[model samples]
Target: DAGVTQSPTHLIKTRGQQVTLRCSPKSGHDTVSWYQQALGQGPQFIFQYYEEEERQRGNFPDRFSGHQFPNYSSELNVNALLLGDSALYLCASSLVQGSNTGELFFGEGSRLTVL
Candidate 1:
């Protein structure tokens, strides 16, 4: 079965620009979450989507948004990006087991460079 996939493995943008990243979840999975990993920091959760709705969000600014489709795929969009927004954007998918003990399968991240 196919695993999580992210698009445009790499991207280059400048300040005040907007970017959109896509993700397709693994087969049989239903939840998709986005994370941002800065150069020297751990991944920071951006938001999560479930059943076509935003189920949870992290400590990110409102400029970050997302969407979930019926097939369990998702997208992350960042507006008015800043140089500091440059990072490895990761997309993770996992089964919605109604608990927090499930495993999250991550895709090769989309590297964004702001110049």
Candidate 2:
């Protein structure tokens, strides 16, 4: 029961730098989704990955992408980050279970601050 976990709990970097956040899904989950939450706002879905491919995506730009491994862990990569990118990078995992809509479980998140 590892639940969802993220690395670099707190990160600080200048604009234009790149950052990679990691996540491990809860036990027995096959799908992982990435979300971005800014101050005072709900998490927005960046993308959802299954079968090692992106199953769905939100309105985020190309700079935002992710990968899901066979073990159900995932990583989110953001390149040429901008000041606006400063936010809580949350990784939510859910068990597909053949459901039309899945439930999400969240991690503590990797906090990114851009200067």
Candidate 3:
């Protein structure tokens, strides 16, 4: 019954550094979506993974990459980080049936601070 879970609740990195954040979806959820939430802003969709493949992506730069494992877990990798990249990285899980994406359950998120 556990919902999505993320690791390294908090982290710090410098500009040009690289970071990877992990996520495990809730039981029975097969799709994972990653988002970036800046201070006082709504969560911005980064990408979505289904069936171990990237199904969609947002406007983020190429520095952002991700992978979905067979177990339905996922990882978000950001290379050449910038100060603007400092934000809460969120992982949301859902069940995808046909063209429908059911309700999303989100994790507490991994906080990244880039200096």
> How big is the positional error of residue 39 in model 3, measured in Å on the Cα after superposition?
0.1
Of models 1 and 2, which has the larger TM-score? 1
lDDT values, one for every candidate:
0.93, 0.90, 0.97
lDDT of 1: 0.93
**Candidate 1: stretches off by over 4 Å:** 99-101
TM-score of each: 0.96, 0.95, 0.98
lDDT of 2 by residue, 3-86 (tens): 888897999989899999999998888889999999999999899988899999999999998999989899999999899999
- All-Cα superposition RMSD per candidate: 0.9, 1.1, 0.6
Positional deviation of 48 in candidate 1, in angstroms? 0.7
Which sequence of candidate numbers ranks them by lDDT, best first?
3, 1, 2
| Highest lDDT against the true fold, candidate | 3
Badly placed stretches (over 4 Å) of model 2 are: none
lDDT of 3 by residue, 33-71 (tens): 999999999999999999999999999999999999999
Which candidate, 1 or 2, would have the higher lDDT against the true structure?
1
* RMSD versus native structure for model 2: 1.1
TM-score winner: 3
